[model samples]
Target: MSTQNVAERAVIREARPEDDAAIGELLVEAFITQYAKKLPEVVYTDERKRELRDVAARRKVATILVAEVDGEVVGTVALFPPGAPGSEAWLPNSADLRGLATAVRFHGTGLAKPLLDAAEDLARKWGVDAICLHVRKGAEGVGRLYMKRGFVREPVGDMDLPSVFLTAYVKPLK
Candidate 1:
């Protein structure tokens, strides 16, 4: 599908190796706003930044899609293959969706919906039975979007991050 059709000003396409840097930049910018002083500095350091960029470049079992406007990336979403290693163990039966970010400038533009639509479409194509994602507390807007998109919240429990209350959102693919 043509990216222009989704959003008049943005184009959605599969992320390429060259997009690693741009995607990493977007991640840092987007996360910093939500995480602010709470997130560790190392998470945004050059080395760890490169690691994220590399992950986007490798693609691995995770499919990363980007949204660009006037040749600049403004949003991104990633869907990992079911059963992929390091996948969210809490939702072992579901495909893991990650790195859903949109440039702050693009906020209220509905750019995120198309990115998510692409992820869900890709997940269905991969024969995934369900989709799962983690949203930190205080990110009510993000959670509400997923809820509106048909995702239901599962119980919170053991996880890597604390008080962050790993809220698992799931949506059946089939």
Candidate 2:
């Protein structure tokens, strides 16, 4: 199908319990598969995979949003309130966004934008002054999307994890 058609028909909504497995699969495919080349194989430990697959665990702390195309889950993103565990939000009154992943087949189909829009809208509704997120430094394409959407790179917030380096980005809502 055409990119435009796929994007036009996609629905962005809060994920239901039944979506847990699909979201987990999408996250693993989008992250581990793509980052394996740039990151060390050791990073793909079973524990890490389990962490990526734990959508229900994340749902307890964040609002899990998914994009469904014709009844198939194709994309997912997590929006976390400030002070929530695993939240990298440093700016006061900011929300944290993470796990923005799209299925390989849906890459470049403009699906991420809607997921991001929904997160930003939810952030505004929650009275946050900004939305913060971390992107793997090697994921230039994903970083570009955030930059294009007005997320400013905050080098001071960059993190050097044992397996991967992350660059922080923040977009002010005010």
* Best-performing candidate as measured by lDDT: 2
lDDT of 1: 0.75
77-110, model 2: which lDDT tens digit per residue? 9999988988888888899999999998888788
Q: Could you say which candidate leads in TM-score?
A: 2
Per-candidate TM vs. native? Answer: 0.81, 0.92
TM-score of 1: 0.81
Model 1 bad stretches (over 4 Å) = 1-6, 37-51, 156-164
lDDT of 1 by residue, 1-174 (tens): 234433566778999888888898888778777566444432455765565666554487678899988788889988877787667735545788888888876766788888888888888887878898888765667789899999887755224463345667888877
| Model 1: how far residue 137 lies from native, Å | 2.3
